[model samples]
Target: MIIVALDPPQNVDVEKWIKIRYDELKEYVQGFKIGVPAIIRVGLEGLSKIFKDYSGLLIADLKLADIGDVMALTASIVGDYGFNAVIAHAFVGYSQAVDELSKTCEKKGLKLILVVSMSHRGSEEFIDKHLESFVEIAKRVGSWGLVAPATRPLIIKRVRELIGSEVKILSPGIGVQGAEPGTAICYGADYEIVGRAITHSENVKQSALKIIENQKQRVAKCRG
Candidate 1:
C-alpha cells in the first residue's frame, strides 16, 4: 500500500492543497498521512472536511511522545477528528505511555502505529540501538503497525524478522529521502509513506501511479 504524506509548502492553502491531492491520488494510494505541517495549518476540522469522502486509512502523524495521560488525551482528540490511526514513539517505554496509548486506541477503534526507528542519519545514534526493545513494546501493546525507515531497507528487513507477519510495517523516506519506490516493500514493509515526491510533483496522479506500478514489479520480482 502507498500512503501519501501531505506535507505541502507552507505558503499554499493546506486544506485546498490536500483536497486536490486527495482527489488526484485517492484511487491509486491506499491511504493519506497528515503530518504536523498540515495539521497546524488547517487544524483537525479542516482535515475532516477534506477527507470526509475518503474511505481509506487516514493516519494522523502526531508522533505523540508525551506522558500517558497527555498522549491518551491527544489521541482521543485525534480520534474525535475522524482519524482512523495514529503514530506514537515507542522510545517512550512500555509501561505508561505506550500501554496507555494502546488502550485508548483500542477503545477509540484507532490503529496504534509505533515509531520504532527513523530514516535520518542521526537516528543511528540512539533509536537504532534499541530496535529490539521497540519491537517488543509494539508486540506487548498489540500495536496495529510499526514505522521503519525505507531509506534503510536492511532495517526494514530486520524489523520484519523481529516482528514477524502479524503486525504491519509502514516505511517512510522514499523519494526525497532517496529510497527507491518499492525497496521497502520488497524487503517486507506493508506500506510505504511517501511525501514530497508525489505531493510536490507537477503531475501528482502520474507520480502516484508510477509508484504503485514500481511497487508491484519489485514485489513480483522479490517473490519470483
Candidate 2:
C-alpha cells in the first residue's frame, strides 16, 4: 500500500503531477496523499477539481490540531471537497476537539488517521515519550488509521503492539528521509506514505513501481 505524497510547491506543478501520477501510477500505489502545502497553494476548490474524478483514496493530510468542533468543521470541508480520509494530530489529547473530530468524520463518512509519531528529528523528544498515550487516544477515537514514522523502527513496533489489529498503520519518512523500503511494514506499517523519492525522481513511475514491488515482497514475507 504505497501512497504518493503529492506535494509540489507550485500550483501548476501540483495539478500537472497529480494528473500524471493518478493516470500512470494509480495501479502502483493504493492511494494519494494531498497535504496542506498543496491545498494551500492551489486552494481546496482548485485542488478538488483535480481529485473529483480520482476514484482512489484521496487522503487529506491536514494534520488538523484544534478544538474538536473546529477540527470537525475543517474535516467536513475536506470531505465535502471530495477527500475521503484525513490525517490529524494526537498532540491535542483525546477529549474535546480530537474526540469530536473522530465522531464528525464518522458521521460524514470520512476516515481519520491520527499522527502518533513523526519522522523528522527533534520530534522524537516529545512524541516518542508519549507514544502510549497517543496510541490509546487513537484507539479510543476509533480511528480508521494512524500515522507512524518509518525512521523509528522500535517505535513502530511498539505502536503495532499497542494498537494490534485495531487500525491501519500508515507510515511515512521513507526514501529521501532514509528509512529503507521493505523495512517499515516488516516492523508493522500497513501502508507507506512516500513523497519526494517518487515525485522528485527523474523517473517517477519507476520509483513508484520499485516501492510497490518492495512493499509486496515485504508483505508476503510477513505473511509467511
Best-performing candidate as measured by lDDT: 1
**Tens digits of per-residue lDDT for model 1 on 94-170?**
78889998999999999999999999999999999999999999999999999999999999999999999999999
Where is the poorest 10-residue window by lDDT in model 2? 9-18
C-alpha lDDT score of every prediction, in listed order: 0.93, 0.86
Question: What is the Cα-based lDDT of residue 123 in candidate 2?
Answer: 76
Given candidate 2, what's the lDDT at residue 151? 92
Taking all chains together, the TM-score of candidate 1 against the true structure is: 0.98
Question: For model 2, what is the alpha-carbon lDDT of residue 185?
Answer: 85
Per-residue CA lDDT of model 2 for 110-160, tens digit only, reads 999999999988877887789899999998999999898899877789999
The alpha-carbon root-mean-square deviation between model 1 and the true structure, to one decimal in Å, is: 0.8
